[model samples]
Target: MRDYVQTAEEAARRAGHVLRAWSSKFTVREKSRSNLVTEADEAAQAAIHDFIHGRYPHHGFCGEEGLSVAGNDSTYRWVIDPLDGTTNYVHGFPYYSVSIGLECRGEMIVGAIFDPIHDEMFLAVRGEGATLNRRPLRCSAINQLDQALVIASLPVNTDRHDEAVRRFLSVLPVAQAVQRTGSAALNLANIAAGRVDGFWSTSLKPWDMAAGILLVEEAGGRISKIDGSAFQLEVPNLLASNGLALHEQLVAALV
Candidate 1:
């Protein structure tokens, strides 16, 4: 497990470097109305795939940039989002990151998220707890919904855009504040680090939440579907919180 975590961290950092180098010069194309993908996203995923496949030839890989390797061993797969915040990166918003998660036999065993602009690496191994830059991390203890700071994402191109807006309206007045950070991976990492109290999103891919979800769970946070059901990687909607009393209220508000 430790080896897996180390490999993921290395891959994330290498991809982060690729992202930083191309941030200023990469060409962009629209994947959809408000969905953007840059040359850096592909390049960074290539760098990550090369590094991981070189080390673990038998392990499978699934990347957001369309790099998929069905290796000999199907039980160990790496889920990667080379650039989690392409729009933010393209606009110099500085909140983008490289997210990598290793799932072994249907369970996430190791995860790493690297924020190159801030030089922060968030890592976690199942049952071993989570950390930021090698220091232990814990979720915030804020138990009151009115005192909790929350974050969310509502991609304009998603089919659930209107539903997300309605959910946002429901949360706005009850929580301390609601923010849209454009990066679900970073939002989940923030929840793990206790930088924010909670996060929910109506649409997300496995690459967007795989790594960050492990970080939150290892850090003693809570994650579920919007209706408070168990969270599955394939499920697009999710709610993550600090495992405080406010979680129930937040879930109720989203209903």
Candidate 2:
């Protein structure tokens, strides 16, 4: 366990360094209509995979770059996103990160997110709470919606967008401010560090939110479906908040 976290963090930090070096020389390509992938993302992911494979040769790997083993053999799997904000990185935006999380038997036990630009590391181990660069972090105290700063991972175009937009519009009048940070890992990290009061999104992959979700919970926040139900891997829609008095109301509005 100790070794896993160490290797993952080391790999993430190394990826961060690579990111900083490549930020100035990035070559971008479109993976889909509005989605993108970059050479930097590939390089960072390769570094992480190589580091983990060198140590744990048989462990399974699943990552954003599509380098994954089909079957789970060692009861542990690494979920990774070498560059969580490729769009921002291509545009020279500074808010990107390397996110790595460990899942044992389908349960997330450890997570680490590194932002090379800022040198901030968010780490979480199940049952051990969470931290940013080794300093313990926690959620905010803003209990009411009117005083809270909320965030969302906006979906571009889907049937769900209308419903999500409605929820966002409803909450906009109540929240002090709303911002989209582009990275789910950092969004959750911000919640854990009390930089934001709450976050919700309708669509995300397992690698995107797995580690960050644990960090939020360990930091004293409450997370559930936009409808106030418990979280599940299959249900990407979520509402995570600093444990507060108006949680139920917020969930009701979104869910």
Highest-TM-score candidate: 1
Clashes, model 2: 2
Against the hidden reference, what TM-scores do the models get? 0.97, 0.95
Instruction: Report the poorest 10 consecutive residues by lDDT, candidate 2.
Output: 155-164
Off by over 4 Å in 2: 158-161
Total clashing pairs for each candidate? 0, 2
The C-alpha lDDT values of all candidates are 0.91, 0.85
**Model 2 lDDT vs. the true structure?**
0.85
Residue 87 lDDT (model 2): 83
Give the total clashing residue pairs for model 1: 0
Write down the RMSD of all candidates, one decimal each.
1.3, 1.7
Residues 1-255, candidate 1, lDDT per residue (tens digit)? 777888899999999998888877999899887789998999999999999899999999988977788899999999999999888998999888899999998899999999999999999999999999999999999999899999978866656448888899899999999999888888999999999999998689999999999999999999999888999998798999998778898999999
- RMSD value for candidate 2: 1.7
Q: Residue-wise lDDT of candidate 2 within 1-255, one digit each (tens)?
A: 778788878989988988888888888888776688988999999998888888888788889888877543669888889999888888888898899998898888898999888899999888889999999999998878888888878775545458777777888887888788889899999999999999999888877888788889889988888888888865778888887875786886675
